[model samples]
Target chain A: MTYPKSINNLISNLKNLPGVGEKTAERMALAMIDFDKEKLGSFSDSITDVKDKIRHCLICNNLSEEDECIICKDKTRDSGILCIVDDVRSLMLFEKNNLFNGKYHILKGLISPSNGIDPEDIDIEALINRVEKEKIKELIIAVKPSLEGEATALYIAKRLEPKNITVSKIAHGVPMGADMEYLDAITLRTALFERKKIS
Target chain B: MTYPKSINNLISNLKNLPGVGEKTAERMALAMIDFDKEKLGSFSDSITDVKDKIRHCLICNNLSEEDECIICKDKTRDSGILCIVDDVRSLMLFEKNNLFNGKYHILKGLISPSNGIDPEDIDIEALINRVEKEKIKELIIAVKPSLEGEATALYIAKRLEPKNITVSKIAHGVPMGADMEYLDAITLRTALFERKKIS
Candidate 1:
């Protein structure tokens, strides 16, 4: 028998989330019954509040509540060196491990022609303008090592070429602690090609 | 760099969902930025609406919008043949495949002593009472074939023994389309023990 309308509605809406499918959505809907009313209220409020309050950082395209994001507003972080990433998640990843000391520019998307996402569709022009206005010394493209990520990085580098700005993409090779047998040909090839000499 | 307050709140709230960990919650919260205002509003409403509108059916403990669940309200189903299931999920699974034509009684909880749950905590009394009041002739215990499920089924059967009710547990065997190589020893033993001869 079909679930009541309310439950079915929840299942459908839950499917809207990334990586959530029908079975997972059903599980989530069923699990909700165990949650206390107060928790549910806060959870509901949490989802709604983000939409109502959060917006883009006018400067760097990072998600923010105010006009400027936390990073943009912070004077402590060095702003001269800008690290470009695909989205807020990538920006957060770089921040989490204290890997990068420079400020960030979130593209919020990458170039993928198959998905109809063109170079102009993303925030490339805004990035170029940010570089010029802020007098950024270095642009480090730290997007994931995917085809689309490479395309976006290359496109951005070409755009900044005329302005005589230094553009560098993050190194792509075998990851740390990865098993050699499991490494794909492309990664192994790239690792060898970009290998550093210790002599 | 930390996300703004709104994003951080959403991330924590998303973590409240079953199977969603810290990283997944962060991913979900970041993904929410792609959702439009109207979609976000409805998604938020969908979560809250279920809590407001849904309740347990007094008769069978199935989740419902009204006092009685859809299955309990149906007069066409065979009320005499009652099926005892672990929860609404099991009830739905049985109903989905047209596997059972009988009425259902949701236990909602099983006899898991390790989890500090006992027979006294579950709705077994309601189930026993329903069997007598409704004159249920056959009780098909269809709970999952697990330790807690067996204990629960045994407890219910023993309780109803004096009433002369015909209580039967569903068979435990290797499922259809299952590969023999991947089958666990217990399942293989069960399949062999419960095997039916065609000769």
Candidate 2:
């Protein structure tokens, strides 16, 4: 499976990307050869630029070029309500949909005992410190709904208990446009348990 | 859908790669942030290195760091039996599987009239020239089985009609480990058409 040094080098580097496998890396490396010099220069420069420029927001662990993320810097967004999420992607998802108009705290990862990840391994301490210092009125757990999500939300809630802040998690139920029969039992149960009454 | 400048730049650049959509590009860019400085540097340098170092092999249009590709330069391989392929990836596939020990002539693309691609758009001229000058005894058209593949192979064969070369195409049949019932109509028909007699 020997290839030319440069081709091999690029292929190997491409494989380090999250979803790219050996075959995909090889295909991508081959595709790059078709790119003109200008495109290649910018592509290469961006890879370096992304690393050199982007850093975690000082306050919320969100991706930012400056000390604080754009959301954190905005004066109008609610600072009293803090949305705790698993990572920046979750924050991005919320932001993209314009679903939440509040401050966010990125935990970086959730607690998964089976996977050896703990609350301490993530940014739980930072979340607690941020909530305390900022005097946030409400804490919303917006992590994914899974065992880890449940554990993380409960842990954060317990931590904020002494501070006497209102802690709540986003509801887990059947999603919009989901087929009822195809829904999982736990989700169905949650959907029924959290059913809203119409006036 | 506003993101930081560097993150947006990298995401847009990543989307240019074949088979990468916006979502996948975002995921890959986000994953790159977890990379250490050394990893990021090497990844960035290699992107530029692949473009700087690799060039088309002078002899067969294969990717190469030198004048000729490794296969074309090898003195031991059978240059008389040249394998004609659509691109370098196809050449690499054959090489990786140890299926061919002969030199490969990359056409770089297939002839697709509907897509406005013609015989002159590919490396057919170089192929014909190679066959005439090198006196290649046999040409194996190892391109994939499709309308474009058929057109490309036939076009090359027509060009070499005056050269008196024994040109043949690779056999198409049912793939190994494939379920007979799940096979598509064209593949099934191809399998039946190319079926061999029992010895």
Candidate 3:
């Protein structure tokens, strides 16, 4: 027999999330059916609250409740340095690790011509504007090293060249704890090209 | 920087679901933030509706929106035969494959002395009551082959012995498309013991 209408609707909605398949969504829906009314209500409220309150930071385009995100408003962070990431998720990864104390600019997406994503489609103009207005000494291109990511980084670097900002891409290499024998050729080549000297 | 309070709360709530970790919940939360208000509202409504409307079927203890589940209400299905499953998820799996045409009984959970789950913890009493009231000729115990499942099935079998109902456990053997070379000793032993003669 088919699931009830409400359960079916919830499963369909859950399938919209990344990596959630039909089986996963169905499992989630069935699990939710066991929740008490109060737990379910609070869960529903959280979903609605996120949609209603969360918005992109006006300055850096990262997720925020107000016009300015927490990173953009923090005075202690190095405002002179800005780390540009592909999206808020990537920005969060850096934040979770406490790896970067600088400000951030979320491009929201990359420049993928095949997927109809161009520079104009993302928040490139805002990155340029932020550099021009702020006293930024360095711009770290923390975008992934894919074709689209490289293209977006190059485009941004060229635009910010006239502004005299030190635009640099994050270093690429074999990840720590990775076996050398299992390393892909492309990664090995990139690692060789970007080799650093040891004392 | 940390996520805003609303976003953080949503991520934590999402993490409470089975199999969803911190990273997956964060991804889900971020993805939901991109959903339109109308979509988010409908999604939230679906979550609350499932909790409000869905209830265990009175007859079989399966998830349902009414007093009885769809299978229980369907007169075309064989009422004289009942296929008992461990939970609603297992019932759905059998239904999805169209493998069973009989009525069903959802045990909700298996008996596990170690986990403090006894026969009283699930719907065993309801099953006995239904068997006594209904014209059930064959009772198929389709629970898993784990220790708790076996004990629960054996207990059910013993309970129904005096009631003159034919209680049978689903066969335990090597699954279809499985290579016998990789089969474990216990599975291979069971497969050999339960061998059937070719017609």
Tens-digit lDDT track of model 2 for A31-99: 888999889999999989988898988999888899988989999999999998887888889989999
Query: Least accurate stretch of 10 residues (summed lDDT) in model 1 chain A?
Result: A86-95
lDDT of 2: 0.88
Docking class of 3: medium
Q: Give all TM-scores, in the order shown.
A: 0.90, 0.89, 0.90
| Candidate 3 chain A: 10-residue stretch with minimal lDDT | A123-132
The superposed Cα distance between candidate 3 and the true structure at residue A169, in angstroms, equals 2.7
Off by over 4 Å in 1: A108-119, A146-155, A158-164, B112-118, B195-199
Candidate 1, residue A65: how far the Cα is off, in Å? 0.4
Tens-digit per-residue lDDT, B110-155, candidate 1:
9999999988799688888899999999999999888999999999
Tens digits of per-residue lDDT for model 1 on A87-170? 777888888889988889888689999999998898688888899999998999999898899999999999888877789988
Q: In candidate 1, residue B167 scores what lDDT?
A: 93
Q: For candidate 2, give fnat to 2 decimals.
A: 0.72
lDDT of 2 at A104: 91
